[model samples]
Target chain A: MEKNKIRSDHPLDAMLRTDRIPHIWCPGCGIGTAFSACMVAMQASGINLDKTVMVSGIGCSGRGAGYTRLDSYHTTHGRAIPFASGMKLANPELNVVVFSGDGDLFAIGGNHFIHAARRNMDITVICVNNLIYGMTGGQAAATTPCLAKTTTTPLGNPDPPFSLPLLAFASGATYVARWTILHTRDLTKSIEEALNRRGFSFIEVLAPCPTGYGRKNKERSLDTLKIYQERTVIKNGAHPMDAVMDFGNSITLGKFVDHDRPTFSDNYDRTCRPHFA
Target chain B: MKPAVLTGEHFMTGDVACAEGALAAGCLFFGGYPITPATEIAEHMASRLPDVCGTFVQMEDEIAAMASILGASCAGVKSMTATSGPGFSLIMENLGLGICTETPCVVVNVQRAGPSTGLPTLGAQGDMMQARWGSHGHYEIIALAPASPQELFYTTITAFNLSETYRIPVLVMTDEVTGHLSERVVIPEAGAIKLRHRPAPKGRKDRFKAFQPGPNGVAPMAIAGDGYGIHVTGLTHDERGYPGMNVETQIEMMHRLTQKIRNNLDDIIRTESYRLEDAEIVIVSYGISARSSLAAVDEARAQGIKAGLFRLITVWPFPEQQIQKLAEKVRGFVTVEINLGQIHLEVQRCAGSRVPAVLVGHPGGAVITPEQIVDTLKTAF
Candidate 1:
């Protein structure tokens, strides 16, 4: 009862594993900010918190599911979406959420993301786009910049980064958005909106991996936040094609897509279960 | 307009029977990828699961399929996925995850020849040993090899039952011969068929340890949305299911994950003995080879040679005790399989110096005929 009182006063406490507090994310990391925003959204979403399950793949940001007090799953690398998709399909009433980093969601798990979006499965996916693989040290990721120095790309990356919003929109993500940790209120609101909506909703939050990406790039955590604040523009209804991220140039951030077709379950129920219906 | 049970005699393929068995076992979710020989199981599930309001998802690949089934199982659904060798190889990564998380799901591997997509259309018992040690790490697992369509039907349900009972993934290691061959399968009434649901969490929901082993070292699983607010991970952790990175945590976690199956080997391991009471030569086999072994045993007996069949129904946690006892009584043993000598190695290990274990096996393209086994036993053993 006393613990309940303390948690009620701190709304987000109820949605966190207080015992598992003091998470593994390093200080000055933007993941903590983005994660806080997510917790706030889930706490205030008004949906059945008891029924919501969080799933994460392997990465530093993949630990999101571990800290949450909901029925959470920290699945294998690149399997969070599929795992959560399985949960949503098994029981359509339950709210399934996938929370992980870009390397997990976009690179290794890229196929699942596109297919799940195409099927329009009702699950909210939050991708922490730190532009590098943080968990496995400062490695070059699929979202790594064309010329970024990292452990693997000490000579500078020859590959281009993916425009995640463009990918999500092209892959049929019903609700697409991009925000940074600085835009916590918007990120929270976007998550809250995705929580209430149906279909495969995706939000890519550009967070700073100070220890991984930042250390090699010569950008301190503060400098990274400064870039997010100054170098990014929020164009709420802009075309996803323009929602690119090239830290040197301007980055576009906003809710890029919000429309729904028949979800996988909707199609399943419509095409199947005649006598049961 | 078929019900999930379809409780009657139906002359169908083994794949169809396996699907029906899953439905009868109350498997509410199936996520799978379509591969040869195993494709029929997915097709059968696609047509049947919807009729029963069960979730059927054809995932992009075997990895996604394996991962999805684990997800559904975590949500309190009896889930399954089916595949062949190529697809089975892809499922290995998440299979480890399922093991570490102690997720209860059924994975059916309709064995075909493979190093990498070796013989797609042919039946092979080559994956029997793969079913034992394919996943990374040394963790105990339950795998059943059914010889016929009828046995496939019962074995699948038994797979799910053991999976739920032990809170671990069970493999229905049927081959393309057993999976594709059409045979008479009598589906018992729903009430008659046994089912094992995972024990539910007890006591206060807030303090529930998600990985705490209950009566039989199997933890009570609380599904998502049940308000138990449990956390499950593929990382090494304690009963609370948090990531505990240390030697002690690894030792404790590995013990619980593995010992659950090891301690209950008597319950988890199952086999069939035929004419072994007064026999001298014992023929050990599983899956399609077991069918041939049974015939070989009969043929050997008719020829005035004392031979009996020791058919391994549950191949993994390899029936050591029974094999050891047989080795003590029998003069020599013939380990018949489709692989070069996978289960034959296990047979040799169990048989020891008391009896010699000979392999009646080949790199599989076709089923090992009864004549081949009979010839092997007549000469080799």
Candidate 2:
């Protein structure tokens, strides 16, 4: 029972704390790729590991905090942001990051996500968007593509899906980007850039749940990775004016938005200057 | 070192004392909403916490406020939130979360009348039972009552330390009267204060279990960023921080959780027995009404009725053993509170069939009077 083992020479071998392996994720899952990208991003940022914190909500993706070597929190569902927000405010020196999923981050935690962005908190958020809920056996998720089959929606997804990058931009994130696990390099780079940004920065990493979502669609891990590779078209900076051009029936992944804004903590401290000497 | 004198400090209120106490207690994060008479606490905390490199946030609602403090606590900072009946009601779930997760934090309830918005800005001790049983499930809580601004200042410090020591949520339960009253509190010298720290793990990192009980029943708790690989969940969990649902895991975890408080009842329980040494009748009271009972007890003693006062500082765990001991010596019990016969039931239980219990109840915002309590004392005699 090696639950979180990562073999050497694997793409994630360098990125992981091999001794801490036997991750909380199930076998043949795509979350390992997302976690690998996260590790690479932290290393690339040159930030001190001592000052880094990873916070996660309750889900399969939420376990990212537990398995990661960095200081981490496994908080309640949809509450990772407020917890991370408090941590960031308590110690402004820490580089805080939130790892949550589409269902946990969007549906139940939708209010917090928008508010965290509105506050323009200076923390990076990497949402592992598997397009389906994998933890509870592939339930219908907020990011599930329209016309897809799931346990709850065995007939076909009737509701429309969100363009998460656009939603992040609308919610006041200073940096917003999207990438699939297959594009590890770009995903890792986007995460690094998000970490360095001054205000709220969000990277939606599209991962595959080969066990739940993939099994339902008769798609294996290789098939799911190929699907992500073929469907995604990278745009250096997608324009809001030509939003329709950037988004279609396919899953669009790229560096979608980048702008500077006063971080929530910085502005809050500035506003309460007399109180915070 | 000289204690901070409250001389000529213009009209300081009890809620303000609580805010100042929190600031002095090294509280660097306050997440709360504005609800009277608890609003002054938030206002003062907002004004003060920021001055000390701390942060104060008026969350979208009380749930966020409660959840935010839990987050702040995990980040290795002393944190707190203030609310009245309704806001306190909103925080029930998360308060339980804090308890089960062993997250040390403070919740101040400047209680107002309520089932739902009973009497805003008016006093009521109706929430005494709610403070103990508001959150679902079984667990122990430490709630302190302050009769004046002086006690409010001292009790807030005690509340934080209790929370940190036992790794449980501590409630500073005050009513509208005491919370709103303006009085002088002699702030103790900072050097004189003894703060409690959560027991930290002693051995190698791999040996640490977030829920493993020490000899005292409390486990060593490391903050999230301390890199202890600690895991906490609202779900029933084993000592290793993994979710546990089996009969054995469930039984052992919960037994330890409850014993963590019950086993250390001597240190955790606090009360003051005023002149109970040779008294024939004992008046049991707490919160604001206890002040009036004290006056009535003094008057009864002067008139030579042999009456005394027992003021419960730690309201939960109910001081049952102390009550039993007092019941043996005293002829009868007179229970006086702003609430109508709530704590009277507890008094009846602890007194058993041996001692008679008389309740002087007040069902509204108005407090119980000493004359009313005196009448009950007469009946007990």
Candidate 3:
């Protein structure tokens, strides 16, 4: 009798660089769920894998770029957006994605986030909002909910967190959506749609950090997912300003902005093509 | 189609000449911010890049501009960015990223006086040491200083070529005087101008190690769309480009990062020696001050003093060996720069206690006068 094969193939095995498996994500961390959804969406979207580039800044989610088998860059802290912008503008044929954390994207890289969205650069930004700086020992991030306990905010976070949907909508993102890690199917669909959309599509995924945010709040991953399932209210086509999150009140989940406009490269070609000719 | 090289003499400022040289060197992407003395470089590139079917992006800030150029270069396009003092300070963080990832790009710092925006409109050589050590790491950098508009044009092209050849971020350290000064620059024909192309990766894509060194210690590069599946990061990474936090990995990574340039200094360092044969007093300078030093040298020679000017074209590898050899023969060294003794420290280090190294510099609102340099030389002797 032949020896039984121990290795089993999975659907995402092709999409990931399996050699880099056993990733550094903590047990019950929601980044893996969000990243898995992104991978599934990438597979479902039918974009050319060879022409896809993933850029990430320094954080836990920054490691996503390294795990993906696609051509990826783990850039410096707070620089993924501009790096992705460079790739997209240099070759419009490529599908560029910026995948990083809330602290990396909203705090240190906030200026780039707004400007890239304002320019309406053609790129998909999947920001995983874990509410705390998970990689750096649970510091209060810009997206940390008010009154949330973090390492830095030992008592409670006094500062109000940014409403990501409203920020993206105001910054001129063509498509903006919000979802929790528990809503994997919905998040995957949003990512697929954003990947197909033309200019500056943004999706903010509220992920759980069992080791960081969860530990401080004394909540497990399952408990947060349960809260997300109970509290999330789907409001498609809702106004971005009405979608602000105050976990004590309610969690709004759906596409908040969907409108088309000329991207930076589109405008560049329209104005400069005659001169080039 | 517009030719890449202009191939004729044209009156242009050093900043504009630097842009033209970038075009002639086949730089297809320029990401920059508008800063004084360097603004004309971006202004010229804005109009010129589109005509040549190149990409030009005015980034939100200097940090983004620096990051964008690195990204464009990783995408298989030769890229560059230009900025002044304050912007140069912002670019230092990502400059380290460029060095760590071994990305090939040219960064032009048209120097202005500043610890913090001191004199944006005036020239200074304050960033000489900053260009070498501003990035917060132990890494070797290649910096070239141009003395005139003509030299800026050629040196810009040389900077790009050297960057590609070494797979490192090369700095074209010019000054506000050199940048704004207008002169006749003759751009050679496209065929006559030498260009260096980065070596393409050759092997199995899955098995390729992104940080592995070749014969010259430069790992072959692959663009994003290529099937290489390369992962580039800023952490101390192994040959496979995976982050390895151990001291052994850091030692190996740092050795490769620094030894490539340090081991090949003979090919990288370039300097111009004028009237140095049997001269008792040597004047060391670069950028605009070098021109002043040369003029002072002529004056000193006319006055029956054995004075020679040693102008640094490539300022960073410091040319320590040459300075060390000259330390024995020369009676003393007089260093002239717009900044307050930045390069003087390097000269002093190279020329030990045996010889005196005096500095004639200021806080840098104006140029160092040739008379001051001559007086310093006479007093030191």
Residue range A1-277, candidate 3, lDDT tens digits: 2557665787899889888888999998889999999999999999999999999999999999989988889999999999888778777788999999999999999999999999999999999998999999999999998899999999999999999989989999999999999888999999999999999999999988989999899989888888788888999999998996767668999999888999998888777656653
Q: What TM-score results for chain B in every one of the models?
A: 0.98, 0.96, 0.98
On residues B1-381, what C-alpha lDDT tens digit does candidate 3 reach at each position? 466788998999999899999999999899999999899999988888887888889999999999999989888899999999999999999999999999999999999989897899999999998998999979999999999999999999999998998899999999999999999999887898999987778878878888888898788888889988888899889888888879999999999999889888988999999999978999999999999899999889888889998989999989999999999999999999998888999999999998998998878878888888778777778
Q: How do these models rank on TM-score, best leading?
A: 3, 1, 2
Fnat of candidate 2 is 0.42
Which should have the higher TM-score, number 1 or number 2?
1
Error of 2 at B289 (Å): 1.7
Docking band of candidate 2: acceptable
Question: DockQ of every model listed?
Answer: 0.84, 0.43, 0.75
User: How big is the positional error of residue B271 in model 3, measured in Å on the Cα after superposition?
Assistant: 0.5
True lDDT of residue B1, candidate 2: 18
lDDT of 1 by residue, A98-128 (tens): 9999999988999999999999999999999
Which residue pairs in candidate 1 have backbone atoms (N, alpha carbon, C) closer than 3 angstroms, thus clashing?
A: none
Error of 3 at B227 (Å): 0.5
Q: Report residue B291 deviation for candidate 3 (angstroms).
A: 0.4
Which has the greatest DockQ? 1
